[model samples]
Target: MTREGRWSEPYEIFPQASGLFSHPVLVRISSQEIWLFYRKQQVGESISKPYVAFSFNSGVHWLEHRLLPPGIEGTTRNPPYVDRIRNRVYIPSFSVYESPDQELIGDSWVEIYNFFSRSWEGRMGPILGGSRNQVPIEPAIVKLTSNKLALFFRNASVEESYICLSVSTNQGISWSKLKNLPWRSYDNSISVQSGRNGKLYLFANSAPAGERLTCFSSYNEGITWNHPKLIDSGYSIDPSTYLDRQECMHHVYTSKDAQGTQRIKYYRIKEDTLLLNCPACWILEDVQESTEE
Candidate 1:
């Protein structure tokens, strides 16, 4: 998961969190608080549930409680995202449709949340400002120097699994028309960042589509990529970007064993580079303390 050996100290955060987390997201509000967003699973439903967790004093402890209400009519899947660019948090998930007995597909919704406003808005409006009939989960957003929020998403349509870009100049109130990005996003959903570097990086599967695999970054910010870099050993599915407590960045993915049990592994940022080729052993270290939503 991470590039550096925790001093080979075997540092990681797992064991307690397994098969219970989906759509994992974290935000460092300050040196003292870390915001966590995730969806808790319902027996038959896969969408409609989003939970919020917090860590105080730096991820040594954790407190998680339900954040989504009941009767939402979908399965809660996918993690939330925290944007350092605007200092707000957003979550995108698939809202399924179900018939009586929950057997059908419902309205698939993409919702975004603002930590400052404490408000939630649907992607159908100017929030995401995309023209796709359907938007795949895992939306990556970053604020450019122009102060415009550029949102990138995986196109569910067959044109290309490439990451599509859209710009919202007015703080997500209005967006530019859809623009096709030469950089595709299939294997991973996080390549968005807030940095001085002009180039952007995307994470996705380099292996053939539908096979589910690992992928790497771009030097030209979606303009051109170097080569397919492998991050996971057994094959990685969904990934998100995370910058941790020590100011170290990470590329995180959920790993599952043969028994179908899953664990979270993260790749640490070292010297501005993510070590994806090493054996995944980086652990999640969180400090837990309760904080109200």
Candidate 2:
């Protein structure tokens, strides 16, 4: 993390281990405290487990690498929505069940963790895959209203790949049937953020994969979305957004260098500027580099 919009030297947040670490999600609990949750798959293991590390000093230092309880996997790929008023963090996650003789099945759900108690309080669902044609995973959630929430998932289907949606009316306790949106996503992950001006924005890689990053805007709380606008190109994937205090939206994603090295890229655009621009207009440019690994 940098304060002056420049890349910092890459450093490991956790020591080397036997397994692989991937899908990191950072949640800021306070001005000085942040929690980093990620997936760890041990050697020779087919399933991944969730682990967390806490940074009490604004990500300068991280301590307490703890595995979450048996059932609760952390955010699959997107960041958790923090409800400060209720002192709960709603984590959009999923579970995968593998059968030796059968295919692997995946489903999406929401895990409610109470920050004050530091324990999981309630679980929303195991929103079934419904059919073998579509497998839902990597949910990105945003609040449409005080009582309504929208959950977007990557449809990991072999025959078709598109973004799907589910809605919750009572704080994620239950969800409506998962429906496919018109958007096509060859990339396996997506990020959604509710802008300051009540518009919803989604970021994902365009179809035919690794082509370009695209943004879709929803004006009616995600009932419908405008066509995607190009954000950047060149093998970018897994874009996530962070809205700062000044209403500037920070978009960070992974892009591959010429030699196939993965590099983190950063882009900043004012929320108001995005709101003012027409949906067909492109407003973002590559701003700076953050880290490379």
Give me the candidate number with maximum TM-score. Answer: 2
Best model number under lDDT: 2
Residue-by-residue lDDT tens digits, candidate 2, 71-164? 6777755678889899998887776676686666777778888988888787777665435766787788888644578888887676766777
> Can you tell me which runs of candidate 2 are displaced by over 4 Å?
1-10, 15-19, 41-48, 98-104, 128-132, 145-147, 272-293
**What would the C-alpha RMSD of candidate 1 be, to one decimal place?**
10.2
Q: On residues 1-293, what C-alpha lDDT tens digit does candidate 1 reach at each position? A: 24764444454344555445555566666788776666566556654366676777787777655465442222222233456566565443443344586433312223455666656544533333234333444456666555555556665544445555555555555554445554455544445554335434456555544234444444333334445545665646666664455656666666777886877676666524542433323222221211211
| Cα error, candidate 1, residue 148 (Å) | 2.8
How well does each candidate superpose onto the true structure, as a TM-score? 0.58, 0.82
CA lDDT, every model vs. true structure: 0.50, 0.75
Once superposed on the true structure, which residue ranges of model 1 sit more than 4 Å away at CA?
1-20, 43-48, 69-124, 127-136, 158-161, 183-191, 209-234, 242-249, 254-293
